[model samples]
Target: MSLTRRKFLSWLGAATVSTTLGQAAQAASNKHFSGYPQSHGVLFDNTRCIGCRKCEEGCNQVNELPGPDRPFNDLAVLDKPRRTTAKAYTVVNRYENDGMLQGPVFRKIQCNHCLEPACASACFVRAFTKTATGAVIYDPSVCVGCRYCMIACPFEIPAYEYDQALVPRIMKCTLCYPRIVKGLLPGCVEACPTEALTFGRRRDLLRTARERISQFPERYIDHIYGENEMGGTSWLYLSGVPYREVGMREDLGITPAPQLTAGALSAVPMVVGLWPVLLTGVYAITQRKEKIVKAEQEQAVAAAREQARAEAQAQLAQALAKAAQEKEAAIAREVKKALEEAAKVPTEQAAAAPPADTAQTPTEEES
Candidate 1:
């Protein structure tokens, strides 16, 4: 089969993407990434938070973000629950605790920074990375502006800078990576007056959360929100109320995000590999059909030409035979005319001399 430039390019593109997808899926399933050991993490205790929004102020100041329309001193903003945005990396939301005298529960919402982040897995460009610091960080230089991370994050933490038209970027909490590495506490954790947010090693925080739950079982739930959810997260949560009450999802299973998507992506290689072959087979069949039609056409033309040549030869032969018969007839007619003329001459000569010859010729001829 003839391989055209267009077909080759199509085959190449399909093969590349399919192979990449398949390899990625296979590798993800084989290797277990639970983040770097001894990586730092934060524990957020809902019971001790006072909804002061001082953490918000500190985050804005540290990140050099634009001030909000409402001041940080305003607690009214907590009434309307808000998610993370380009301007606000973290927001404290207030949820009412029904029937419990504990009143309203405030939950700080930010990136959970999963051990196996779905964002990093979804980004084919390698723009997002899970650093040894346990921070899921993004590099904008390599980002393709594909908001796949937004869809991949179960926490829905990644936000797009839609206002920046010239160069939009994904915005999320960095887990205060820069500050943590410098032996400094995160801005939010540092600013918290109630010590609600604790910054420490992930294992230590898990132990601390367990101890709190074990010591005061009635005050806090038995479960740690991020311990095994989505294959664990650097950020853990301890709440006095049901986790669902504060918009924290409890349904995310222990399976990592990469494994969840691998099953579907793993089939792409086989499917994509078959398509090009099938198309080439179909193309070859079409080419074969064209060749057969051309051969049939050539045969038909050759047969018609042969028949025409035969017919012309028969016509020529018939013309030559007719001419020969006409020539013979003409020659015969001339011969007959000549014979009649000769016979007539002889008879006329005899008639002219007949009377004298009958009387006198007897004597002259006899003498």
Candidate 2:
């Protein structure tokens, strides 16, 4: 899928917000952590598990998860290898161990609840919490449904609720966090009749795993899985054969999940701080370009109007000049007519004066 810029920025922003929200917790996680003091954990002895799926039933019952398609009593489900699902927080898988004359070994799969949980580190909403009780619990209310926790998990324990489209949740084993808090054993540990699942303080669990391995060197492997894997998980394992024989990954090194992803996640804060400024600058530049275009349009219109006004003014000036010239020509013609009429009056009077000379001698005799 194509990662759009807006989506990328949103993820970065969420990461930053998560960091800010959990800054104190994150700061403490950066240091060398050796698990919380007196925190509880579970130890699964693979040699003892009978593939009963009792733990699976207990988990479903205790967590109130949805009923599986196949009932927990059905052993037929163990034939196929299965991972934890949204409906099932834990599942038991049967592995054919060629090293064991017993023919097959059972392995229980669930969230390890790592000491430094990658889920907590990867979450951009601070949805996952590594509580003091050794349970990495999740709060669905705060979850943005990013699902980064699913990817960051070394065991790939987190499951998505695909059925609930409106409000999907990332589901996983909480280690029976509520049960532990109330001084009760986890339902899975209580349900196991063969003593395959052991629950106690994390430190004590490690001691117990070591003792079992040392006591039965011939029957089990010396290495206790999760002792240091992903910087020590709350759930440790003791297997008769190699872990890889049971579909478990042995290559996930001792480094904590948070440290493994710190390099990439560290850049989130920088991006978060700079993204808004970058967007603002882009907006400003866009606005400036728009303003320039608008100004140019206005100037063009103003210039066109000015040119029209100038043309109209020049036309009016020419008309006024023509009218003045016509008025002056008419005045000059009237003056010339007046001068000709004035010159004609002297001639007419001279004609009348010839008769006056004859009448003047008669009037003098009459007087």
Candidate 3:
């Protein structure tokens, strides 16, 4: 059977439409990042924590971080609250809760390793990596000191080395990825003798967290920190008092930090990419308008000049005609005057001379 050209075209159009629709559907369904499955994670139970700096010491020893000004054995370091820094990957800070029965609560602070890790998403150079072992690691070689990761992190974990004259890198918790891959626990978790920090699969940790909360309703807060906060984090937290009292942000919704700027960043390329073209088009239009206006002005000026020249020529011709007429009238008057003078001269000569009869008589008498 022979198909008509129009029918063939119609069938091709339908197939093309179907293919496009299918692609769109697939793109919509597969929304982008699926966080690492069966990833290892840590759960920190604040109720069991004894404000010991063993985890900090363990982190420094394993990561080979520089020695601190105060010795790890010095319990006096916990006197003042401290944030994570280049030298220290982790810190345990004590918060005094007046309302709670427990006088002071100790909470460990480190990189949360968010599911959609903001540092990884923020880095344009791909300096940060979110590994399958639930570790968010930083590569210093690729970092250009943008400080975008520091800004993007909701927890504000990434720190910059300002003192370093050159080759400054962002510093943060690695979640002990090297040890986890080798079937060993993180330094902090290993050092935690009280079992405050439990290392296990992220899914299992979530279950364990729920079980702890269920087992001791009076001892723990109803909600688990990092369970759903910032789209869930590998490092979970359990607090005796409210998370807010302990300096932890509870208001940050479940949405990831990167998602906040995703739409804006996506539109950036469109805006930046088309700016030159739009500006060029505007310039061309302005130039064309200016040329048209100039042409019109030139045409008007030329017309005015031509009109003035024509008027001057007409005036000159009129003056020339008037001068010619005046000259002709003067010549006519001179010719009349000369004719009159010549006539008078002839009359005078005739009068001065003898009459014709007198002359004739004289001639007769002489003969």
Q: Using TM-score, give the best candidate's number.
A: 3
In terms of TM-score, how similar is model 3 to the real structure?
A: 0.74
Ten residues in a row with the worst lDDT in model 1? Answer: 21-30
Write the residue-wise lDDT of candidate 2 on 1-367 in tens digits.
2368568767777878976564433433546889899899999999999999999988889999878898989999999999998998899999886675477999999999999898998888779899999999999999988888888887989999988878999999999999999999998999999999999999999999899888889888889999999889999999998999988899999988767656665666876888778986998899999999999999999999999999999999999999999889888888888988998899778868797776688889999
Whole-model lDDT, candidate 3? 0.84
lDDT of 1 by residue, 326-351 (tens): 88888888888899888989778887
Give RMSD to native, each candidate.
8.5, 12.3, 11.5
Candidate 1 residue-wise lDDT at 190? 93
Once model 2 is optimally superposed onto the true structure by TM-score, how far is the C-alpha of residue 358 displaced, in angstroms? 99
Model 3 stretches astray by more than 4 angstroms: 1-34, 145-147, 160-168, 316-367
Pairs of residues clashing in candidate 3: none
Model 1 error, position 50 (Å) = 1.4
Off by over 4 Å in 1: 1-23, 26-31, 285-367
**Decoy 2 TM-score against native:** 0.67
Which pairs, if any, clash in model 2? none
lDDT for each of the candidates? 0.88, 0.88, 0.84
